[model samples]
Target: MWSFVGKKNQQRWLWHAIDHASGKVLAYVLADHTDAALKSLMQLLTPFGIEQFYTDGWGGYARLLDEDQHEVGKHYTQKIERKHLTLRTRIKRLARKTICFSKSEWMHDIVIGLFINRYEFGLPI
Candidate 1:
């Protein structure tokens, strides 16, 4: 799943693939929430051999993922939703209403990338 950042029309999405068993973020893509964007994320996850994708009823998910492998429902996507909540709590830019926001898409992506790299993946920035 993904969340929007920045103002409307100028917003960007932070798409994520979370491992249910480990509760770790697998891959993420920063882009518009489109089929092409989701396709890129799926490509990144291809090496992991993901057999099933549980996501919301997003048209992109339904269109890109195989019907049999796609499970559309809120119950199945709790982990990712919780991850979204964590992101929102930790990243002020992701908050629903906040004056602090990235002025450029470059800064937006870099900030979020650093956070995920250092905090989520435990890599030194």
Candidate 2:
């Protein structure tokens, strides 16, 4: 989970799932970094038939995913971490230490969602 501040410095987590091999974005959810948000991301990833899950040391991953399939470390999660960098570069709201940010949660999500869908997933906007 990655987060950015929205209007009034309200933090919003970007819960995203990506393919390890191809580095393609599978799904994403904009919400708090909580069990419920992780569950929502898991539901989206379920359709992909993912066999392994690489994550950080987040407790939600441990609870939701099978022990055998879950691998915890920044080393294993490099692809997604790189993807976050790409997002930060492309989207001002995602950039750390930037004054350029979304004024509303709705617009913040819409901009990020459209960028991911069009650029990452190759869907027409």
Candidate 3:
């Protein structure tokens, strides 16, 4: 998922793979930018032999997915991309520049993970 720090700030970050078929968010980490984000995402994805993957024209995605069965530069990734937008809208805290409200990084992870699992995965809240 590509996310920005705020509407006023352009600093973007990513959360790793979301299983579109199952609506399971496989992994997530706070990253610095697209490069670092792709590196971590690749690491997380190494175990899975994906037959095909899709993404936007993020340069880092090109580099990492070069070895895999990736389909880039297409509009097919729009679904997962839109999911990020839904998450940002639903989770007010994730919306731009709201506050430094995470109690701690660990707590932030737990809360966000739970939220994603409940809301994104259609699990019972």
Give the number of the best model, judged by TM-score.
Answer: 1
Q: Please give, for residues 18-121, the per-residue lDDT of candidate 3 as tens digits.
A: 66576556766666665776678767777876567776666776776664677666566565667777777876656645665444445545656777778756
What are the runs in model 1 whose C-alpha is more than 4 Å off? 1-6, 96-99
Q: Candidate 3, after superposition: displacement of residue 109 in Å?
A: 5.3
lDDT of 2: 0.81
| Candidate 1 lDDT by residue in tens digits, 27-89 | 999998788988899899999999988887878887788899999887777777787787788
User: Which should have the higher lDDT, number 2 or number 3?
Assistant: 2
**lDDT of each structure?**
0.82, 0.81, 0.63
**Over 4 Å off in model 2, which ranges?**
7-9, 96-99
Task: Tell how far residue 39 is off in model 1, in angstroms.
Answer: 1.0
Alpha-carbon runs more than 4 Å astray in model 3: 2-12, 99-111, 117-125
Candidate 3 clash figure, as a count: 0
> For candidate 2, what is the total of clashing residue pairs?
0
For candidate 2, give the lDDT of residue 83. Answer: 84
Model 1, poorest ten-residue lDDT window? 1-10
Query: Residue 55 error for model 3, in Å?
Result: 0.6
TM-score of decoy 2: 0.88
The better-scoring model by TM-score among 2 and 3 is 2
Sliding window of 10 residues with minimal summed lDDT for model 3: 2-11
Q: Each candidate's TM vs. the true structure?
A: 0.90, 0.88, 0.65
